[model samples]
Target: MELRNDPQSHYALNACIDKYYGSKGLPCLPYGGVQIRTSVIDGQIHEDVYEKVYFVARKYFIKYSIPIDTKNCFAMLSFAIGPNYVPMTWLVTEENESKFRVDNTTEAVVHNLAMLDEYLAGRLI
Candidate 1:
């Protein structure tokens, strides 16, 4: 589906970024304007490949002491502004009410994170 970029969505998107990223940056836009760069969780994939994303996310859950159960959450990409602020993968609860950034460093992750906001209101799963 096409992503929404109306005034209301932009405002809400900015607010969400501020809340999650804090003072790091605000008013950041997706790198390529309304496109998802990855299909790991956003589309169909092989079981092994799909698990790779969770494997990475789970590592962060343990390192960061995130309390959410593994089965109850899904992974999504994060919004990043610049070089110093690399994009991250996020573990989001099924309810979509809570999210925690996962530690990931790779060009593919960066592209996915940058374009994720353009899909499913910042979600892809």
Candidate 2:
């Protein structure tokens, strides 16, 4: 999968998620203005393969916050094996209008990109 580093291009992430999971009709929640959800069926059949869908989703949302606010949003992507396996959830929030709080590492990368974009945009304008 291609990693997007541009904040303005966050629409790509939504497209990717829609292409992959939208057809499945998975359950999702609204978190920080982003729709968060999980895949019901395992995309791949492999042991010890930890899926990081939530983190990835959160990253994209938080990373592209300059164009929007990531607060007042809640979403989760859970993994389960026939009622077994622990599910994971990722949530994001903004302490203030400018600062974001995320619970995943991938989201951190996104946040940095957002800050960079905002800073650069400010300088350019």
Candidate 3:
């Protein structure tokens, strides 16, 4: 969760995340997830609208220790929003990309990576 989050909200969020990490052997953060970007116009990229996330900045790796249930299901919980923590059930994607999910009810398989780019922008599952 490479956070350069609001200073006012950073403390509690960090603490909650830390507690989860402590239980996970402190492997640090989960840095990879398929993100779906939707801010573009009709899925078309605008040169002027594109922005670099970090040219060179501090990276806050956010991670958690979640175990799958008896049904081989588990959700990734996030406390980055302070009190409004969010969770997304484990899903199977084409690449499996560690912790990536493609949410589409119309199709069972995920083909478009573009539709998954927003997760990097802090979109809830």
Predicted model with the maximum lDDT: 2
Of candidate 1, the 10-residue stretch with the lowest lDDT total is 58-67
Scored by CA lDDT, what does every candidate get? 0.31, 0.32, 0.30
The lDDT of model 1 is 0.31
Lowest lDDT sum, 10 consecutive residues, model 2, at: 61-70
Error of 3 at 120 (Å): 20
Q: lDDT of candidate 2 vs native?
A: 0.32
lDDT measured at residue 95 in model 1 versus the true structure, 0 to 100: 49
Clashing pairs in 3: 1-62, 2-60, 35-116, 35-117, 35-118, 36-116, 36-117, 36-118, 37-117, 37-118
Against the true structure, candidate 2 reaches a TM-score of: 0.24
TM of each candidate vs. truth: 0.22, 0.24, 0.23
**lDDT tens digits by residue: candidate 2, 38-74:** 2333675322111222223332222122111123322
Candidate 1 — which pairs collide?
A: none
Which model, 2 or 3, shows the larger TM-score? 2
Q: Between the candidate structures 1 and 3, which one is better when assessed by lDDT?
A: 1
Q: Residue 80 deviation, candidate 3, in Å?
A: 16
